[model samples]
Target: MGLLDSWTAGSHTADGLTYPTYRKGSGPGVIVIHEIPGITPGVIGFAEQVVARGFTVVLPSLFGRPEGPASAGEALRSIARICVSQEFSLFALGRTTGCAPWLRSLARRLHDELGGPGVGALGMCFTGGFALAMLADAPIAAPVLAQPASPAPLGRARAADLGLGPADLASVKAKVAAGCQVLGLRYDRDPAVGTRFDTLRRELGDGFVAVEFPGRKHSTLTEHPQPEGVERVLAFLEEKLTTKPET
Candidate 1:
């Protein structure tokens, strides 16, 4: 059977952009942005675990083949396609990717339907930093950046930039100041992540919670889903998304 075997499939359109989405489970909404090269088997596995944890998980098919397995050739092909796609920011520095707006809209809509303090969003690899950008608009209560590798991590400027334009950066900073916290996880030796985590610390200060593992692993929840990293992510989600008892 395929990775997305029993999941319900559909498409979400916002701000003139549409992409396929798979959903499962129940409770608060959590949008799982798949890594580049598409929704691979490992990503599907992680999504399933999220579902098992009681949250309604929505796996967005942003790039690559949604049913593709995680293979080197598939990853390279997807990388080539995304590098040329207008939806991503493969080279631009300090500019949010074009796909961010669509994602933000989707998050708002999901939060509205789900009806909670807000919704959760977890982005991996090229899409990792997207959750931070999504925070500019409200309703993203839980934002996780797992190994954000965008703008190709080619230089210092691109390496540290979260791809947020000036205005969006200001908005995100405001949210952080207002007490919104973001979770980040990455391998200590992953070059693709650049120094973005350092940038997060410098900019967000205590608002950023970073969990670093000691290794060269790149895909935190997919290619190599570390037990500790997964536990941290799940606990973060529960803390942020779970409702508190009335006094």
Candidate 2:
């Protein structure tokens, strides 16, 4: 059976873009954007954990085959497709991915239906910075970046880019100033993450809670699977989305 066999499958369309989504559980909503090579077993396993933690989780298949295995071959093929896709801003510095609007729309829809403080949005690996971008427009009270690798991190400039444009960055700053906390998890030596964490620290200051593990591992909540990182994410989501804010 497929890894997603038990989850309810659906599709979301926004800004003239459509993508399939797998959903499960019941409670406050949390959007789990899959890593490269799609929703592999590892990704599914993590999502299941979130669901078990009492979240209505939605897994968006941004790229790669859903339920596909996480092999190097699959990763390469997905990377090739992502590089050519107009939806992602892979090499562009200081620009949000074209798919951000669609994701924002999905978050809004989930929040509107659930009617909580707001929904949680967690993006992993290549899509990691997306959760931050969504905060510019969506009611994403909880934004988690798990090993965000974008803009390719090729040069010094790209390495420090937050994968957000000027306007989006300004909006995110405003949100942070208003008390929205962003949770970021990564290995201390993960080259794929580049210096985006440093950028986030500079930009968000104490608002960005960074949880760094010690190692060269990537994919904090997935393939590499750091238990502490996963628990930190769940706690952050619960605090931001379900807990009432002080008046």
Candidate 3:
């Protein structure tokens, strides 16, 4: 059986789109969107940690083989496919992916079923900024963007867009004003993640929590797995999802 087979497997239908999903654990809800190469071992490992931390983690397999091993060949194939897929805006600046609405619906359903303060979402690699995009819905209390490398990261415009259109960007900003904090992670020298960090800082101000690492490693939770990053993410999730006595 695939590693995903060990998790509860199902399908979610949202905004007339259906996708395979995996879930494990119990508590508040957290949607963990995988990178371009799908639900690879490394991504699964990260999700397992989230589950162990007491959140019901939901992973939607957007591309690549579900629960596949992380390999250069597979990564290249997934990248090529994503480059041509209309569901994603490979080189478009300031436009959300076609998949965003569907993801937003999924987040709403997860929050409706497993409520706490709200839901947490972590999007990595090509889908990184998706956590931000999902903020169009109000239930996303904590959004984590890890190495959000989309639009091929080619030019300044693409680097600054954060894969969001103007209206969605407005919604995200409004959410920040409502006390929904966003967490971002990237390497100091990863060309895949251009100046979007600066954009986020400027756009969200104190609402943006940025964790920058030295060198060129990408994929904070998977591929390059940083222990500190993992801990920071978990702490952020706990802070947002846990219920505290009213002071």
Candidate 4:
């Protein structure tokens, strides 16, 4: 159903977990993390975009099993549907809510099994800062965060997200101190990812770099003129995890 007419999408299982995913393209590995909309048409388009850039892009379906992006206004309604359908258990909610530990394992397996030194991550919107959390593990060599929603959920969402909750903040600071670099982008107008969120970079000392788009909104990277943004994302990764050109 995507431009990659020969789309080979299915479920990938590792460590006893089965995750629905789409895989294609060639080069170093790059995992594409979808925003609140789930893997909607736009995100699949982004996956195709990344594939065009010469990287093996994998978009996993983590919307509590049966997941796909819905209408903007119906996101909450969709959440309710996923909650009830997933059996609504506390532990299940914690595991399915955040894309951290599982994604970490997937990246590691890709590096160890798929034969890449490591993998690059592109996380956006609600998942903006997720790439940073993925970096907590060394297998993620390059992390790209776009329009990261700041940690201030009107409830439990904040606790589930990676917004530096003291202990976790301390751990990330340690990774940055050990020479990890994270690149993040945001539109100046979106209130979810505000100036205060920039403190995460400040907290990281020199390892964090944030670039701002003066007028672009939260979903700015939905398409081009955003091509350059996507290119920069790959370039940043190559800078960190580049392999020698073949002889």
lDDT digits (tens) for residues 173-201 of candidate 1: 88999998999999999999999999999
Evaluated against the true structure, the overall lDDT of model 4 is 0.65
User: Weakest 10 consecutive residues, lDDT, candidate 4?
Assistant: 87-96
Number of the top lDDT candidate: 2
In terms of lDDT, the poorest run of 10 residues in model 2 is 237-246
Reference-based TM-score, model 2:
0.97
| lDDT tens digits by residue: candidate 3, 1-247 | 6777779999888766788999899999999999978899999999999999999999998889886778888888888888897778678888888889889888888988987788998998889999998987648988999998976778678877789889999999998987889999988899898888999999999999999999898888898989999999999999999988799
List pairs with backbone clashes in candidate 2: none
Per-residue lDDT for 84 in model 3? 90
| Runs with alpha carbons beyond 4 Å of true place in candidate 1 | none
**Worst 10-residue lDDT window, candidate 1:** 82-91
Error at 53, model 3, angstroms: 0.5
- For all candidates in order, the CA lDDT equals 0.88, 0.92, 0.89, 0.65
How much RMSD separates candidate 1 from the native structure?
1.1
* TM-score-best of 2 and 4: 2
lDDT, candidate 1, equals 0.88
Off by over 4 Å in 2: 243-247
Q: Could you arrange the candidates by TM-score from highest to lowest?
A: 2, 1, 3, 4
Tens digit of per-residue lDDT, candidate 2, span 152-210: 88989998899999999999999999999999999999998899899999999999999
